[model samples]
Target: MKLRLILSFFLFTTCFTAFGQEKKNAVIVEKGLIKVSVMYPYAEGKTFNMEYYETKHMPMVAGFLGANLVKYTIEKGIASGIPNQPLPFMAIGTFYVKSLSDYQAAIAPNRDGIRADFSNYTNITPVILVSEVIK
Candidate 1:
């Protein structure tokens, strides 16, 4: 058991080194919560698109960008703060990024693929916000 723990610790350290231990360009005002609120129109009915986004597209984009997915939630009833309550099926994903540059680099190469994934939807907007974890 002790040997296994030591090995795990070594592997963890090695990964940090490989990924660059220095935390450069970290925003002074770190983003606390990252939320992607996708608003879908009533005309098309977002069931099919939602499934595709969850099962296929989300993993690819998040994995490609090195962001650990926090969670995905769907809003069924009337959501607060909107006059008409526009968004029907909303999906939220949270990720901890070392820096904005790191996040940008991860998504830069996969832009084309990401765009294609949302092509079927009438309207799709991907929003990213970073924040510091509060102690």
Candidate 2:
């Protein structure tokens, strides 16, 4: 009788635990989507105007990207995982587009203007990464 009660309790707890677990919503990207990340590396003497970048530069860049741009995100670095370590990047700007060619075409004409606007925000040379979204 005791063994039966213990078994029932274990089964109840297992089922309860399983049901109580939270499910995370997954974001699925469509095929052929391209992700562009522009990372600004941190340096002692480097200067970054977050306000100008957020308010002016990104909006202008998005305008240049036009309808080709699906969405864009900007992230500011706060702290490193390791204590007392310097952050690798000061800021990161990422944009998603359906077609790489479309993105390229959109930015091609405005490339010089985009580059010219950098001095208004930061002195750091941005590292750019273009990749295909797998998931």
Best by the lDDT measure:
2
User: Model 1, range 1-135, lDDT digits (tens) per residue?
Assistant: 999999999999998886664555333334453444434434344433556666676667668755434444443334535677565434444444455466667778888977887776325454444555553
Worst ten in a row by lDDT for model 2: 22-31
The count of residue-pair clashes in candidate 2 stands at: 0
Tell me the tens digit of each residue's lDDT in model 2 across 1-135.
999999999999998777666322333456678999999999899989999999999989888787778888899999878899999899999888888898899899899999999999999999999999886
lDDT of each: 0.56, 0.88
Cα TM-score per model: 0.47, 0.76
Measured with C-alpha atoms, the lDDT of residue 130 in candidate 1 is 54
